[model samples]
Target: MAGRVGVVAVAQTKFEEKKATEHTAELMYNVTREVMGQTGLEFKEDGTGIDATLAASYDLFSGPAGAYMFLGYVVGAYRREDERVLEDGSLAVYYGAMQILSGHVDTVLLVSYNKESSVGKNLIEWVGMDQIYQRRIGLDFVSAAGLQAMRYTTKYGITPEQCAKVVVKSHRNAANNPYAMCCDNITVEDVLRSTMLCDPIRVQEAKPTPVDGACAIILASEEKARKITDKPVWITGFGSCYDHHELGYRDLADCEALTTAAQRAYKMAGITNPLKTFDLAEISEQYAYQELLWSEGLGFCGKGEGGKLIDSGKTQMGGDLPINPSGGMLSGLPVCVAGMQRVAECVVQLRGEAGDRQVPGAKKAVAHGVDGPAGQLQCVITLEN
Candidate 1:
């Protein structure tokens, strides 16, 4: 782990909720080429190729066997000799990091693409709902957030006004993100007045149904990193964990998976108090209530105290622990690309390259991602200067 794996270059497309005309591959290729160009790595001119290529997009999002071949060409790794193009982009980043640490690869490229707009459903909650038990009971994703929000409010006395604040805060924060899919001057009243997608969880409270986009990040070992970029954001620690997929079997209010994952990440980074140790955070707030729920899961506050924590402005950019400076998934969700987008944003922030949305003087950041219905899968990565 000492050789050091750092993100050298990162690029992303503007997130949107619909892309009816363009193919997903077009965005993926554009982002990949942009990131590689930033690394000054040219295939024909440099002779050295990326040690590995990783991409993520579930089978349902893309039409069929056609998408794989499409990706092969976009990455410039189209059946290169015996080289394998990994399709699980998130897992690819995990393995890419392992390869760099294990002396197998000096550099790796991670890409993820998903177009929720192309699919005829609310891709966010639709994908997570149980295909059998839960979906049969009419348990869609918005209801999942509503259920969790209700549980959180009941357990902690979080009021509707407070929930409105989270929505307003996210939109206000997102206004600063140029690549964000949705943002505008919105007030707490605006959130409360919006159409309710699910009881207690309004349309504005939810991440916009993602349109289409792709993201890519170039990772290099210490030796390769120093040669490429002067400011390389080091990957100090990473942790991922999963909870019981059955929503009925677990405490809906608490994210034990996140707690455990955060603990491991903090341990690896040698951090004990996240509030005091980390300068900023890019938490996944797919729902307004989740930002509050995960704040507790991440140990930003005592159990049942996340509502109060937000009330005190402790998570604002100028506060003690700013969370979701990118406006988070609430602004946009490219499904598979969302998690990696969080990572790339952190790296950009760490490198002082986040143009208008940069958190002032940010040196350390914690990015979080969730997969599965009812928060079943969680990934936590801690990055530092």
Candidate 2:
């Protein structure tokens, strides 16, 4: 907590089915310009504006060897230090915070983009898996998520109806989010009846059609943050963990990596009880069941009790601790940028800028993100206004 870092500004593009008109860099520039405009910062290299830049993108998904090739045009990385984070965009935020904490940078611009429509989503994800073990068997995120969902439900007695509620809630919350991709009114029955892509995982239960979008945020040191904005969402705590890469070697029903990451973040933030400490949560629930599974891992409920937690209505907008007021990943945020969008939503909520989805008087929040098969890698970030 010595060199505190705060989120000064955040911006995101509207999630769309296809962004054919604009290239990747163009999409990213839209978000970067918005954040820079809000903070009145220029893209200078004399340490007068952003001191560093961090970009997140997947080479396989972006159709380029070094995906960051066009990112420099938007983040203004002409002369200043800049790096590419190949993982989830949330990692870029994490790295930016570290740069500020290291006393080397006062302001860092973080951006991430994914154009799922530009490439075969499945084929791209397929290449990321173990070619010999997983890829040959046609293991993708959907099937892996189905395996995890089945294990979690069987262990906890969570019915498909309970999982459907997650989709219903996500769609409902998305109605108030302008950036959300799918905001149509939907019910649990609708979700249950939706096309079945995988067992216990209906089309509605899984993430909506992949969208093309970008997100940008500016992180600044305590001194610079105070000057940029009066309301700065401080990064109180953060941690990440990686589980076994081989799906067979791990228990899909449990998220030990997320649990350990949350525990480390909670301890660093001095949060003894996450359920009562944070006003709300923004989680990267790529699938409906993931919300329940991850909530348990985050200590919002006991293991095997995620179903009961959802039934309690405690995570609704007006509930004790709302989750995913921005509709979360389920609303069709791009994969790589989903986690950063969660962080941006939390920042908006904490700053009282989340117009329609704002939780009343939200003072603190927690955001979660994951990567790899079955969420093998997980990251947790705690924020305070």
Candidate 3:
């Protein structure tokens, strides 16, 4: 792709249960400062610093009418080009990349923040559902995920033990990640014996740890990227899709939206075989079973074979196609910031800067994120060094 938009620098706060001292604006400022400091760029209109800014935040979660009002001061968007995205933070990256590709900006600053502990998480999530039908049934992300997990496991004959393995792997991998919140060494037995939140979804198997964090990334045009950093992670391909809105109308076992999104990304990246093409994947596995389900959706394996893929040990750290070397979303990234963290992890690996969790000689990577009920909306981004 010509006029490539490359990730030159990325920054993120340590995932924690609560950022007690820092407010949402402070969190955003911290990450933005780090990225700007890394690039030695300022917010100016004379083509000397970031040409534009993109931010992501939810008004309900941030407890403000216009959440971007808090970020504009930190991102230095007072009199510059700035826009707010109401979806996942990864969408900012997608939109920023498009702006660069359109020859409108040389450098774009992207930032996203979420403090899950500051609000009633359930109330915020419930508001996003279909108020007429899904909202009254008492379904949030967890219950919706449970519904998908039960269906996927039942149809594919995936056992509870298989799902437990995903949790074990996530925590084990997170041990090397200083920014991850859940890095405890756990076993499949521990997972199986943990509290059961819903049928087939154990407390450990679900997002066991909720976190508060912020992430920022600097995207530059091909010309400016080479000057900003020698190891620029290029955004080669990206795509997003939306599935059925209502849970009753959709097939929970198959992630048609995710598959279509991945296929669109793979086609743009000239990747014919995803299983052998990318060195690693950073998936937003909101639940233990999602790792297996999303692996199938990403075409790492055939349909209903996610369990076989796990059993093959191919997704292990030293295995053929390692998945979530940074422990992924299971390690406790904030809800809206989850996908942006995946993109940051990919940038770290592609730059050969992941100190302990580095994938050796990794040149290409895929990062995924989903929103809405039961993975209704999906986004896939492919990056290369």
Candidate 4:
């Protein structure tokens, strides 16, 4: 076997409107403590001595540069000189899992949280813009997504009403999610009548921001995972890829990165037909249209057919394929932690502990993550029973 990885434990805070003003490192340390406590791995013994340690986090939402500095101190890793920190929290968790799978570390801790309540909503887009090619034109994530959605609709011939249905379903499903930021039931008509943030994209269609939350997951090798917990969610496949950064450089209607990433994941997992192989999906749907876009990108549906698939109710909780049963990003966008939560949610579903939102008889699932404007970065993971 090349390498094996599994999630051993996970913990999260209730999504709040505002973060409690705790230092970014403090929040991460608490989440880390929760994960260690649950797994009983804080005091590992290896031949009469504890082994090495690994950790990572991002500083974007921490309101400080190198927020991990404080986190390392709180976690008792400050004295060690070998600990590594990746600035991007999502990438941090990605690397944490990689370390365990590659045999570099037997145990790894992945932590990510954000105080998004304090930053401007469009901060990422503003920073992602190129000063010479894309800045000063007032372009942000909303506008970029609006452009993508507009092009998707124009190419696929989807109507705004069709898009609103996604929001309607998301809210309906989110009502049962205790950690969801938006749990209120909303109708398609309500979504269409809601405030229009961008043409063809209403306020309800876009994910509301400023969600304060923290989450972490512990990962270990296959043998270690089996010994740690009775219920271990195996990571059968993991793949990530990046598209061209410039908006005009890639196709606005579809995601090439998604297709490539999914291929790698499916190959690793030995999956032939995704719709027939996977039981549920936790995709990065920042907007309703993205669900449609990604469904096609992931081969759940063909081009210009996602709308029809949704209309047929094939993706509902009890339908042939359940998508976003955790309410997805449509219910909450906790910034850095959102992607890892997708992975954790899939693990939760596979472990049969998803509570009311669990997918019945679900054995395999997919978790998708995206970053930057125009959907520049993408990651996909496939899990199986």
Worst 10 residues of 4 by lDDT: 43-52
Residue lDDT tens for model 3, 96-158: 898999898899999888898888777887888888888888888778888998999999999
Query: Which stretches in model 1 have alpha-carbon errors above 4 Å?
Result: 43-47, 80-92, 123-129
Best by lDDT: 2
Query: Clashes in each model (backbone N, CA, C under 3 Å)?
Result: 6, 0, 0, 0
Candidate 2 wrong stretches, greater than 4 Å: none
lDDT (Cα, tens digit) per residue for candidate 1, span 225-254: 989889988888777787887877888888
lDDT of 4 at 381: 84
**lDDT of all predictions, in order shown?**
0.77, 0.89, 0.89, 0.76
**Pairs of colliding residues, candidate 3:** none
lDDT of 2 by residue, 276-353 (tens): 998999999989999999999999999988898999999998998899999998888989899898999999999999
Q: Would you list the clashing residue pairs of candidate 1?
A: 16-211, 17-210, 17-211, 18-211, 55-89, 56-89
lDDT of 2: 0.89
Candidate 4: residue pairs that collide:
none
* TM-score for each candidate, following the candidate numbering: 0.93, 0.98, 0.98, 0.93
What is the TM-score (0 to 1) of candidate 1?
0.93
How accurate locally is residue 7 in candidate 2, as Cα lDDT from 0 to 100?
A: 98
